[model samples]
Target: MKRKHQILTIPNLMSLFRLCLIPLIVWLYHKKEMYGLAAFTLVVSGITDVADGIVARRFNMVSNFGKAFDPVADKLTQFAMLVCLAVRFHWILVPMCLILVKEILTGILKMAVIRKTGIVEGADWHGKVTTVLLYITIFLHLAWYEIPDVWSIALTALCTAMMLISFILYGIRNLKLLKNRKY
Candidate 1:
């Protein structure tokens, strides 16, 4: 059990900042010329995300609110960036829809696991890898709007595959947790 959690911690504030960047990212994505600005803003958001985690752990400022809120911020940012990219890259929808299903099923399973195990499960390593791949794909598309068609498709496929893998792994873990729950 960790201590020193409070609502006003720096990590929570960083998560809040990331959440607030969504609209700007979306708007900039649409403007075309502002893609650079959008990419820069997204980079800042990503940096803040990494910093928040480091700050949270290093400072022992991890709060329940932050543990919940950080993932929400990450998901929203990814979703927003994907939707913005989907307009230009139709293949982006594959991961977007896959993530939609993944999140929904995982959300339900997470709740059941928590009820059975009485613990809020943190994200696993596969989930973190998927997140990184998703961000990389998004940034590539944004930063290199004219990226060769083949590369775009390849990256999208890779991101989708990673998400699918993580989805299955998370499902299995959650089910096992439910099965092994102490009654």
Candidate 2:
């Protein structure tokens, strides 16, 4: 009955629920042209994500499944939004590309490192902040229903910078971990 094995519990099911909403959000955005509804869906999904994590921690429900599924759900939600926005705006493709590349590379690197070293990667504070900023930036775009003006650009730039910083921090942390290992 170790904690890591409870990956298929209720909280994880809730996390899966959030992942299931991505298609509905995208459908609202593209077919119905309901940006407001899409934003609302995003907000709901985000809240559920936070709730699932909190529930898992508070109730001692941490499981390997939760760890894996949480990030996968998060990536799916964000990537779904990115694809929808990029298709609609076309101008955001560059930044979206950068973000996706960073995420994918980081994921691959994490897996390889974990396999070699037996250390699981957890989301650090900076990574969490970057995720929050990304959600905010996309939410604002949905709110505005157009290319954001100067303020949004500034905020997006700030968020992107934070994302990069978090990326560097994760890399450094892993390097230190490797140095300390007996391998």
Candidate 3:
């Protein structure tokens, strides 16, 4: 099973576009005070995220680079949104920090696993659900300026809890993989 490293594939291009949207979204949300455009950018990024995966699997255009690049783009976009929102909603910082920590630890574990076993443990159902919840939470914050402060805080806390659960599950899976490795 020779994995390709092609860079010109459709999915890779879509992932790159999603990465490009991060800065634009930040500028719109923070500098220009264009919440509508910012929210739209996020929606587009999310659409592309799903589209890339479908195209990759449907067209058999999956590559090692795509496998890695797609998730990096997704995380960066999510982190950018969190940072932008945290400027206004301080509670967002909690989930932002948790996500940062989770990404750092899981990223290291993932690389170690790939080096040892040549297997990339992609996003599980829990991780995907966490991502969806994060997106929904962000959208609620962005789209509804009238949302009560308490509600926003509660949603952010819920997102944080789900993220923590995802982090724990990934950690357990990685530890199991490490334990099974033959020294």
The CA lDDT of each predicted structure is 0.88, 0.80, 0.88
Report the lDDT tens digits of candidate 1 across residue range 59-101.
8887776876888899889988988888888988999999889
Estimate the lDDT of model 1: 0.88
In candidate 2 the C-alpha lDDT for residue 140 amounts to 80
TM-score of every candidate: 0.93, 0.89, 0.94
Collision pairs in model 2: none
Q: Candidate 2: lDDT over CA atoms?
A: 0.80
Tens digit of per-residue lDDT, candidate 3, span 63-109: 87787788899889899999989888888999999999999999998
Query: What's the number of clashes in each of the models?
Result: 0, 0, 0
Look at candidate 2 and tell me the lDDT of residue 92: 56
Query: Candidate 2, residues 107-181: lDDT per residue as tens digits?
Result: 777777777788776688998888898898788877678655576567667766887898788777766766775
lDDT value, residue 122 of candidate 3: 65
